[model samples]
Target: MLARMLVLRFPKEVVDKPIVTNLVRNYNLSFNILKAHIFPRKEGLMVMELRGNRKDYERGLKYLKDIGVKVESIGQGIRRDDEKCYQCGACTAVCPTGALHIERPEMEVVFESERCSACELCVKTCPARAMIVMFDKAVELEEELA
Candidate 1:
């Protein structure tokens, strides 16, 4: 499954009257949304996670752009890292969408990509920083630098 995380900034008038419900109703692709309170308080930040075929995803982006929302950043093809995770539940607690969960028996962490709202709280909260977020390309982190 291909997934993308995008941060959108909206104009004041549009932000005050968010068209979330309308977008959800219109889009055929599945999506999760998260709102962040940033400076210029009313401006608002919207994080969207889209899942489906490439064509559907592209169509969704165009629809959002048509609504006057500015795309701040776009990350693609992200997947969770189960092996590096310890089921600590820290990520789950921080996740606004409840996308991460600690499952028993295997004592591993599970991720529902479709449920991820792209808030990025889990990424910041993870002690191990094991949760991998991939864009169009993979990132190389040097442990020595840390």
Candidate 2:
């Protein structure tokens, strides 16, 4: 099976359509929506993880593109600033994927970027503003990390 974190941008014209539903019904894909802001008659943005077989996943991507959904890989969109963090663990409380968690023995917060779904919960919950959301600069941030 192939599972990937994706950032989907739906244009206003197609925002009301059942685009994601078609991916499940026609392409045999399953999705876990981490975050979404959809406005009827306006644009929509969603962060989700789509899982399915390799061939089905490819077909689903094509289908989304054909229908005018802009798709992008969720590449290093969230980062934790160790210098600014005080190990408060507030981010861990709201992190749905457990990407941000406290280390048992050391009592320190650990950020696992790979496990993060780009949900932005940690960014909002971090009291120290250590969790940074870099959606617009995601590609550049990925390059910097590499």
Candidate 3:
């Protein structure tokens, strides 16, 4: 079996297609949609975890690309700007993956990038404009660096 986190960008033309259904029915794959922003007649975006047999995974990916769905790995993730942040813990409230949290004794905000889902909730909830997305790997910074 194979599993991967993929971001599928679909053009407006194929917005209404039963692409995901076809993957399950024809390719014998399972999906967990992590995030999506799709609307009819508009460019759509979907981030999901796909799991299936090795051969089926390969064939299904090829099919996705062949049908105008732009596929990319979810290597990029969330980051925090320590200089801009005040450790207000506002972002922690909106973080679904518990990537952002508050620490005791010092009232510090610690970011566990590994637990993040790249959902962008922290970005939207942050009033101080402290959190940002890193378009690479999501790794927690050392205390001295951050």
Candidate 4:
């Protein structure tokens, strides 16, 4: 199955539509909703992981665009500043994706960009102001490790 993290913007006009349901029923795609804010008559945001056949995934994405949904990939938005972070583990507590975790032996906080959903929980909860959110996705985790 092809899996990807996506940020879907539901316009006010389509806020009440069954767009997600159609993705499952019509395109045979499976979705895991990571975070969502859906209010009636207002634009909504949804972060999710979608998995399915490559062909079906393409069709599903096309359908979303055709129906006026603004779709964007969840880029590498979660950033950590090593110089400022103190390994407090506060960010780990609120992270729903477990992208932030503590290493058992050394008691150090670790970040895995691949697992991040970019819900911005860590950014808000970090007391050290080390966890930041950015829009670039070009950087790889291995490069940071090096």
| TM-scores vs. true structure, each candidate | 0.53, 0.77, 0.67, 0.76
**Residues 63-126, candidate 4, lDDT per residue (tens digit)?**
9999999988855467899999999999999998899999999999999988887767798799
Q: What is the lDDT of every predicted structure here?
A: 0.64, 0.84, 0.82, 0.84
- All candidates in order of TM-score, best leading: 2, 4, 3, 1
User: Model 1, range 35-115, lDDT digits (tens) per residue?
Assistant: 454445366565666666777667767877887878755654336676677668788788776688877788667898877
**C-alpha lDDT of candidate 3 relative to the true structure:** 0.82
Model 4 stretches astray by more than 4 angstroms: 136-146
Off by over 4 Å in 1: 38-41, 52-57, 76-89, 92-119, 127-146
- Candidate 3 stretches with Cα past 4 Å from truth are 1-5, 24-35, 41-43, 48-56, 104-107, 136-146
Stretches > 4 Å off in candidate 2: 134-146
Of the candidates shown, which would achieve the greatest TM-score relative to the real structure?
A: 2
Give me the displacement of residue 145 in model 4, in angstroms.
Answer: 32
Superposed Cα deviation of residue 46, candidate 2 (Å): 2.3
How does candidate 4 fare on TM-score? Answer: 0.76
Worst 10 residues of 3 by lDDT: 137-146
Lowest lDDT sum, 10 consecutive residues, model 2, at 137-146
Q: List, residue by residue over 35-107, the lDDT tens digit for candidate 3.
A: 7778889988787878899999999999999999999886657788889998889998988778888888888
Which has the higher lDDT value, candidate number 2 or candidate number 3? 2
Query: Across residues 1-146, which tens digit of lDDT does each residue of candidate 2 receive?
Result: 99988878889999988888999999999999876778899877877889999999999999989889999886546888899999989998998888888999999899998888887778767879998886774544334323
